[model samples]
Target: MNDELRLKIEEYLGGIMSTSEATLFEQEMARNSELKEEVILQKQINHHLRDDKLNAEIPENEYTRRIRTYVKSDEAAHIKQVLKGVEKDYKERVKKPRRKNLMVAAILIGALLLSGIGYWYTSQATPQELYASYYSTNDLPSVIQRGDKDSKLAKGAVAFQENNFELALNYFSEYIESTSELDPFVYIYIGVINMEQGNIASANMALDNAIDSNTLDSSRGLWFKALTYLKAGDTENAGLFLKKLVESTTNFNYSKAKDLLEKL
Candidate 1:
């Protein structure tokens, strides 16, 4: 089957198809024996993939070997060529007595293996661990202060800079309470702190508030909100926000957003 049909089958297997799409697909499957057979094969693959007993039957190294054994001839040839290039580069570096190049090549290979393994492992990671990998507070603004350094917002900025998240959140909350409409960055900081505190839903709400503001850094709110979803392991919402950022031509993170959307 074509890639579109194959993806539809996979989505059906994953139970992600919309009701209308599923109904149409089911009707199509009734009339197409090949589609029905492919669906069955996909279901079997999914079953084995998720079966602890089937997975535990073979050690990881044996599974790796099995996967290698099935690599197409052309793909194998391409991989061999890539490895040969690395080998040749390493030998040349050794001949020149430049150890750094050899180290770089070894690192390159290790990174390839790690990235492939990491992708699979990341998909199965808990929300907390994923958050640890992706969540980081943005740098503090550098503009001249409009308020006194002793002000609550200023104290919050200082606390945030020092990584004292709770103190920062409290100070920002005080400042927000005293102001008619606080800076968008205040809500962003509050959201980040809430996320670090394991209050994901609260963090998202704070970020939504930030995004609805009229501040110059408004687009950054969307970026951080998408990141919040990513930390929560909600790829669908993360992709949605990232896609939005990519579509916003004036956004500073547009290119990065596009790259991240592709990865998701």
Candidate 2:
């Protein structure tokens, strides 16, 4: 408010005031606290306004104009300096978008890798191929042993699968030559294979061998014999063999035989 006090405050702020000015200001502060308070406020305003990073966005020309305004009005400088923090120079905040982009790209790549591996696994394995890879599905090993392709019994099974009755009969007959141990089911399978190839008479003969095993025929073997008879259009013989399975208390195949008989 006074010329002397204003000049004294300016000199003190510029670091050119005498040491006596500090003592005088302390005494003056007790007498006129308002002026001392105003001087203290001016110093705080000058500190923040002088900081460049605090107002990085103030254009060069505008900053020079603001500096001139501050040199003239201490009170206006305080208001403008406080506003410096309000318009924060936020170039560092731009990095947030880049971080989000990287995160999305990482997720996309992970999903693609998982999908590719899944597709590759399925493409290399088919259901039938998986089945053929195994030697057996039931508890028994394969009917044909490893590297037993030359065996007559093995040949019969292959020919039967191919629906070649004439060739299957020859191989099966040869298998029977050394095997009193052969299960009657083997004969029943040959008969069924024969019927599939349209050899009704040979099918009947093969099935006859299954039923006349002379020893205890498997209820399963007898069931297949009945099935063979049904295929040959001899329902009477089919029903007879089927009754064997139906009547056997311990026959696991009895349920299937009864189901088949009901359908017949």
lDDT of 1 by residue, 45-73 (tens): 77778783543333358877868776856
User: Against the true structure, what is every candidate's RMSD?
Assistant: 20.6, 36.2
Model 1: how far residue 122 lies from native, Å: 9.9
For each candidate, the alpha-carbon lDDT, in order, equals: 0.73, 0.60
Q: TM-score winner among the candidates? A: 1
Output the lDDT of residue 86, model 1: 78
Number of the top-ranking candidate, with lDDT as the measure:
1
Location of the lowest summed lDDT over 10 successive residues in candidate 1: 135-144
